[model samples]
Target: MIHVAQITLETKGPRLLFLRKEDPVRFTWYEDLVQEEKETEVFSTTALEAIRLAYLYWKNYSFKTLNCGFRYTLPERDEHGNNALFHQMIASYSSMNGIYFDEDLGHNCFVNFASDEAKNLWKNLQSQKRL
Candidate 1:
């Protein structure tokens, strides 16, 4: 099961405090802590919430001019595998605007912004120090 937590734009921007400043997209997965384990892998809590908020705010400010798209993949794993996989994709009307988050059930999560528009929106959200 994929669990997602979201923050609405109308709410004060303090919710982003949960994220680390130098790297807002990456966060520790507190629920997965196993003291006995020799190693713990840090992960994103799924940046869907942040991305959605930014997308909504951008969409509103853009007068709903462009259509955005979202794709979700269910968590899955092979019977012989020990971990599950999760994936998410977002795109805008223009092929130039999009982002991809591939959480491969490991320490190295991949994030890519297809265009500057998508990158700017993420930056704008993270930089909201007062709003």
Candidate 2:
């Protein structure tokens, strides 16, 4: 089954830490690891809680709005063979909003605001595909 693996956001400093559905002790361990690896303070509790909430909602529901004016919608079906529908939906919305989606990272996907460069890349990529 599809799962919400991670949520990444662009910030002024280092990326915020958001744990998934791990126990408190494990989560703390992950936080410590991030601190050691990144050498940056990661806000785990609040950010992780937020990501958990968003993930739960997305798992049960279809769509959600991010802090920015961006909205994320999950695909309806879980068929492994076809991602065309999902890609098409993302492409249409991304084009309209000037946003671009990154390659799927495990269970979660990443999207960023489409600047001129991103738009051109997305357009070029889309032109060669059916969906």
Candidate 3:
């Protein structure tokens, strides 16, 4: 019963709560908090699995760019001097995975895990700098 939500301006319905568009996506794992908010989409089994799926989505987008004449060695920069390829990959990944994304406002990927294992997994990923 893990719940996941993306902070976005758009709401799926009246029940969905919207966070500020600029808020960064965060991983939260607490039963009481989730219990308080009953409208969140209850999907996903664990935070680790959700994160791994996101990574795979990113990897899938990277492969698509490589095939589209984007360089793997030297990535092209966007107008903001950010890596264009990386942004593109992130956009694709976020959209495909039901995370919120805005070209101007930016994307924030948020997740809520229902189990203690998910909390440990998040801490482990953070310690390893893999998140």
Candidate 4:
């Protein structure tokens, strides 16, 4: 089986074992009612790494952003200004879903982990307008 983990405060819950169980509304947004198939995140091995990837993904949140709409645009501050969009989106979509172990999809057996404090930290950072 592929062992994967996510760093989130919600370590012990149904989410720990299930994918796309965070927000039913959001999940349904991308699901096909006829097929009953829902969209889910590709987790990583570390929470921070996962959040970092999410941040980059949010930075380039656009149509055809990437495979499955996940992009990895680095958050860099140039003469223009800080790249706050990525941080903002990450915070907005913060959800500390936990680890997962899947027997299928051997190649993606392991992905980066998401921080336990990703949701909270992102919320706080957003509140402070740090992003």
Give the candidate number with the greatest lDDT: 2
**What does candidate 2's lDDT look like per residue over 1-131, in tens digits?**
01112233344322222233234433311221332323222223443454445455434333232222122333432333222222333443556553345344223232333234334533543575512
Winning candidate number (TM-score): 1
Report lDDT per candidate.
Answer: 0.29, 0.33, 0.30, 0.29
Each candidate structure's TM-score, on Cα atoms with residue i matched to residue i, is 0.22, 0.19, 0.18, 0.19
The CA lDDT at 78 in model 3 is: 29
Candidate 3: tens digits of C-alpha lDDT, residues 8-74: 1233321212111112344322212322533223223444344344335334233111111121211
Assess the local accuracy of residue 97 in candidate 2 as a C-alpha lDDT between 0 and 100: 54
lDDT score, candidate 4: 0.29
TM-score of structure candidate 1: 0.22
- Stretches of candidate 4 off by over 4 Å are 1-37, 62-131
Per-model C-alpha RMSD: 14.3, 13.3, 17.1, 16.4
Cα error, residue 119 of model 3, in Å, equals 1.1
Q: Could you tell which candidate, 1 or 3, scores higher by lDDT?
A: 3
Worst 10 residues of 1 by lDDT: 31-40
- The segments of candidate 2 whose C-alpha lies over 4 angstroms from its true place after superposition are 1-112
